[model samples]
Every structure is written in structure tokens, then in C-alpha cells.
Target chain A: MAKTIKVRARAKDGVVTVKMLISHPMESGRRKNKKTGKLIPAHFIQEVVTEHNGNKVLVANWSGAISKNPYLSFKFKGGAAGDSLKISWVDNQGKSDSTTAKIK
Target chain B: MNTKRRLFLKGSMAAGAAGVAMSAGLLTPGMVLAAWNEGAFKAKSVDEALSALMGSSSTEAGKIKIKAPDIAENGAVVPVTVSTDMGGVDTIAILASNNPTPLTSSYELGEGALPYVSTRIKMGKTGKVIAVVKSGGKLYSASKEVKVTIGGCGG
Candidate 1:
């Protein structure tokens, strides 16, 4: 597991806007080791979901072609200030991480 | 000079002029240098690359939004997206502030396409994730801090 996942949500006109960033390497397995010349194994996040107040707002599918440190932002309907937004993700290695954000 | 002599001289002069002009355009030093430097998409950092692509520094924040995970378990495959509500949005760029090459990717929005993009990326460590949007010839940027728990590069 990486560090703490942080999410920030702001509500305006009954819409909740959320911003998030996940820490990952997104290795493509195409890189070679300098010493043994062995190809690195492929590892990257596969999917992500953002739910605002129990409603799905954004769903993303990713691949190894992405660069390092993936970030995303989106908006959903009907969330007031102080409501919570849940974000979850799964990686290629079968590891999963989730975090929550309070509407501000 | 006689008619034949004049005609021969004119023909030789025209041929020589054509050959010289052709070589001048095809083999000039400037032309060779231009050809060698054709690709101008290289950038050393996120800021430099964004400035180069947008022709200006980006604003702090406006209508653009960037989303990602707070703590990414892996660095190689972090998902990212940028969405904006502004009209006339021309381009969007994602930057990892702490990566070796921070400028991850950029997208040019088509006329009728949605002004949003989603992609994955790798991270070396915890850093600010930036999204820069180009609209109406001005650049706007927003960033969020992402914490990396496990090492993404090698760990």
C-alpha cells in the first residue's frame, strides 16, 4: 500500500465536484534492468470509481501506457456540504485502495 | 555571336541556372539544419513543457478539475482525468510534479469532442498533480497533492 489517499469535494448548485490523486508507479514491463538485462514485469492500476453520496459519478479504466502519478477530477449531482465522497481503485496486481472525502 | 552560338549559350546558361537553384534549395545548410530539428516536442520538466505547448504560464485555478487517488498503492498505473466546463477549451495537460519527466500527457480537444480525458500514469513518489487547460488563448491550472505510500519506481 502507498500513503494516505486524500479527496476534497466542493458543492455548488447541488453538484459535488471532487478532486483526487493516487500514488502509483504504472510500470509497463517494457523497461530492462541495467545489471541483468531482464525485462521488468508489467504493473499498473486497472480501474477507478468515484461515488458521491452513494451515487457513481465517474468510472475510469487505465493501462500501462499512462505516465507516473495519475490524477483525476469530475462532478456529480446532489451533494451538500459535509457529505462524503468515496473513491476506490484496483490495480493489476489485485491490490485495492479506497478513501473518503467530505464536501466542503 | 552567331544565332547557333547564342542559342547554345542560352541553353547552357538555363541548364546551369536550373541545377544551381535546385541544389541551393535542396542542400542548403539552413535547410539541412531545419530538417534535423523537425521534432520540437521535447521538454525537460512539466512547467517548461506546459509553457512551451501553451505559449504562456498557467493560472492558479479556474474551471478546470483534476482527480486522482490520495495514496496510490502502485506508481506504475495511477488513473487520472481532467474535466472542464469552460467553452472553447483547446487543450489539457497532466503533470506529475515529482516524476523524472513530470509532463505526463497532453490532449488536444476536437471541435465536438468532450473537454475531458482519462488516463493512467506512474509516479516516483508523492507530489502535486497538475492539470493545465488552454482556453480562449489563456492557460488555467489546478493541482492536488497525492501521497505515495509504496515506492512506485522500484519498490
Candidate 2:
């Protein structure tokens, strides 16, 4: 599966800042289908987790209110150049994906 | 509005939608409601939802820095960042006061995680964007009012 998540981690002044974008529909289920005129089922990433060098850094519980292709960013303590940073997300439908990046 | 009353009203509204879905044979009511956090979303008051999310009504006053634009051109997407120097921060939750579902989302930070978070959220109207930080088993919060505008018409 193509990694729908894109991540970038940069270490500056002993702090690691991570930013990411995930591709997903994030349908709210309240909107009607243009053709069928029927309500669409809600589909969105419900959980996101970020890790740094094998240690958990941040975790989020999200919902459909998040716009499609959600963008998230955060900073953490103690990240060195070449440190591994990973981000993963799971959708309401149980589908999941992950991506990894190296701190610059 | 009280938390329980608002929840009940919202639940009724959801049930109405589910009724339509059921009659149309589109889906089971439970299936539709199962995907989201009904309690947090239905909450009509910030304190109501925060208490439920943070597991307490009492919060200690602490330093919580919230960064957001004073004005938003589009209500569809508004950028907000929350960060704090507080130690042992465990969770960060964002709430947009005035949105039907005030609680946008909450982050649970594990041991050794940072106390910063950023994201974009939707707003239906001009209101306060609140950020709640949980640290050392206590909740602290700060909020900033963002004026939402539509086509240059500020609301």
C-alpha cells in the first residue's frame, strides 16, 4: 500500500519539530452525494501516533471534523540529527497506514 | 446548556438521521453512530465536554500558550497551535466554542513525549478556540477568540 502519510522532522536547538500530511477523504457523512442524493458514510482517520527514536512522542484521537488530507505539526524534546521519526494513523473504518522520516 | 441535556438532544437528532438511513436501507443506526465519540461531540458546553474528556471538572491555573490568528478568512480551515513548558504533559485537546461539536480532538502523549501540538480545525462561526493541556494529573487551558469571516463579511 502506498504510504498516504508524508512526514518531515527537523532538529533545531535540541528540539525536534515534526510535521505531516495524511491523504484521506474525511467525509462527514452529513453531506449528500451529488449524483445519488444520498448521505455519504463518514470516513476519516480517527487516531494518529508519532514516535521518535523508538519512543512515543505524541498521539491523537481525531474525528471527521478534520478536513480531508489533514495536516499536523508538533515539537518534541531531545531529537538529534539522523534520529528516526515515524507517524501512523488509523481510520474509522479500521484501515491504517504509516510513514517514517529521518530528522534533518 | 447542561451537558446531559445537550447530549440527549443531539442524540435525538442523530436518531432522526438514523431513522432515515434505516428506512432507506442504507445502514444500521448503531453502525453510523459507532464511529465517533458521541459524548464529546454532543456536549453543548466547554466545561461539560472538558470534564468528560479530562475526567475532572477542576483544573489548576497554569501556563498554557495558545497560538492562533485573531482573524480567519475561511471558516472551513483555521490554523491553531498549542504548546506549553509544563512537565509531564499527558494530553492536549482542542475545542472550538460555538461549533456544534466543540471538541475537535484530543491527543494523548505517552511518557517522554512533548507538550506541543498543532492542527487545523473547522469553525461554523466566530468563537473562542480553546486549548486544554493535561499535565501532572491536572488540567490547564487557554483560549483565543478568532473572528471568522465569509467573503469579507466578518461574523
Candidate 3:
């Protein structure tokens, strides 16, 4: 499958700022299908983890209230250029995807 | 050809088992992944959601900083950033007071991670965007009312 995550990590003054956009519907289970008139089942990212050089830096838990195609940005200290950063997410339906990026 | 086909079947079985384990809560990838507060996310009120996520909903106000728009043209995607300078920050949670399910996102910061988070959340209508920060084993919070011209959440 094609990667569902896009990440950008930049190191500045010992801090690595990471921004990521994940492709997901984030259906809240409250919206109804326009034609079918049936509520859409809730399917959203439940957990997102970020690792910096094999060390867990941030872990986020999200509800369906998050916007579709969620965007998250965070930062961590003590990171340098060329370090590997990994971002992954697990959805409510047990779907998961991960991608690794290098700090610039 | 038989050997290659056997390898394919073995790989698929492993993948299927992983999917089942993940859905059954038997395979938690990370320690923090178990912190997904289902009760908190399903809570209808802000206080209830907070209490479910944290032990208590009571918080010291004016310490955390919440950066969001005062007026949101689109409630479906309101950008919010919560940050604090307080040391020993453990967690950060964001909530939309007027949404059906108030809690939107919660974060646990690991060592070396800053006490900050930014994301976009949905709002059913004009409501207060609350940011609660847990630092030094205490909860501190700040909120800003965001006026919404169009309601989100399909309401």
C-alpha cells in the first residue's frame, strides 16, 4: 500500500521540530451518508507515536473529533541532523501505517 | 514455485494474526499506546471527559497557554496549539466544550520532548477550546472561546 503519512523533521538549535500529516477519513460516526442516509461508522486514528533515534518522543491519542486528514506538529530536544524519525498511527479499525523520515 | 507459495502463505498468516491481535487489544505497540482513554473520548461533557482521562477534572487555570483563533470560519478544522513552560510536564489534552464528545486529543510527552502540541479539531458549534496541561503532578488549564460561523460534526 502507498504510504499514508507525510513527515517533515528539521533540526534547529538542538531541537527537532516534526510536523506530519496523515491521510485518514476520521469519520465521527455521526455523519450520515447523503444518499443512503446511514450514519458513517467511526474510523479514526486512535494512537500516533513518534520515535527519535529509537527513543519514543511523543505519543498522541486522538478521538474522532479530530479533523479529517489529521495534522500534528511537535518538537523534542537533543536531536541532530541526519537522525531518523519515525511516525506511525493505529486507527480504531486496527489499521496502521508507519513511515520514517530523516532530520534535516 | 511451491517454496515461494509457502512463503507467501506464511507471511499472510502472520499479517492476519497481527491484525487480529491489534483489534483485540492484545498487541499494544508501545507503552503509551495503551493510554488511549476510551471513556474520556466518549464523555459528553468537558468535566466528565477530563475526569475520565485524568483522575480529577479540577485544574489550576491561567498557567497553560492555548493559541487558537477567536473566531473560526470553519469549525471542522480549527488549528489549536497548547504550550507551557512549566517543568515536568506529563500530559496535554485538548477539548471542545460544546462538542458532543468533548475531548478531542490527548498527548503524552516522553523524555526530551517539549511541553507543546499542535493539532486541528472539530467543533460542533461555537465553543470554548480548552487546553489542560499536567505538570508536576497537577493539572493546569486555559481556554479560549472560538466563535464558529458554521457548525461541524455534521450537526
Give the candidate number with the greatest DockQ. 3
Q: Model 3, residue B142: what's the lDDT?
A: 92
Q: For candidate 3, give the docking quality class from DockQ.
A: medium
DockQ scores of all models, one per candidate = 0.09, 0.32, 0.54
Model 2 per-residue lDDT tens digits across residues B27-76: 43335446445677667788888877778757666788888889998876
Among incorrect, acceptable, medium and high, the docking class of model 2 is acceptable
Docking class of 1: incorrect
Give lDDT: candidate 3, residue B78: 96
Instruction: Judge candidate 2 at residue A62 and give its lDDT.
Output: 82
| Cα lDDT tens digits for candidate 2, A17-103 | 888988888765556777888878878777888887677788787866666688898887788989888888877666778888899
Best by lDDT: 3
lDDT of 3 by residue, A10-102 (tens): 999998899999999999999889999999898889999999878889999999999999999998998999989888898886679999999
Q: What are the per-residue Cα lDDT tens digits for candidate 1 across A35-86? A: 8888878666555666665665555545454765566655555678988778
Between candidates 1 and 2, the one scoring higher on lDDT is 2
Task: Report residue B138 deviation for candidate 2 (angstroms).
Answer: 1.5
lDDT of 3 by residue, B1-155 (tens): 69999999999999999999777675553443456788899999989999999989999984778889999999889999998889999799999999999999999999899998999999999989999999888888999999999987994
Q: What share of the true interface contacts does each candidate keep?
A: 0.18, 0.59, 0.80
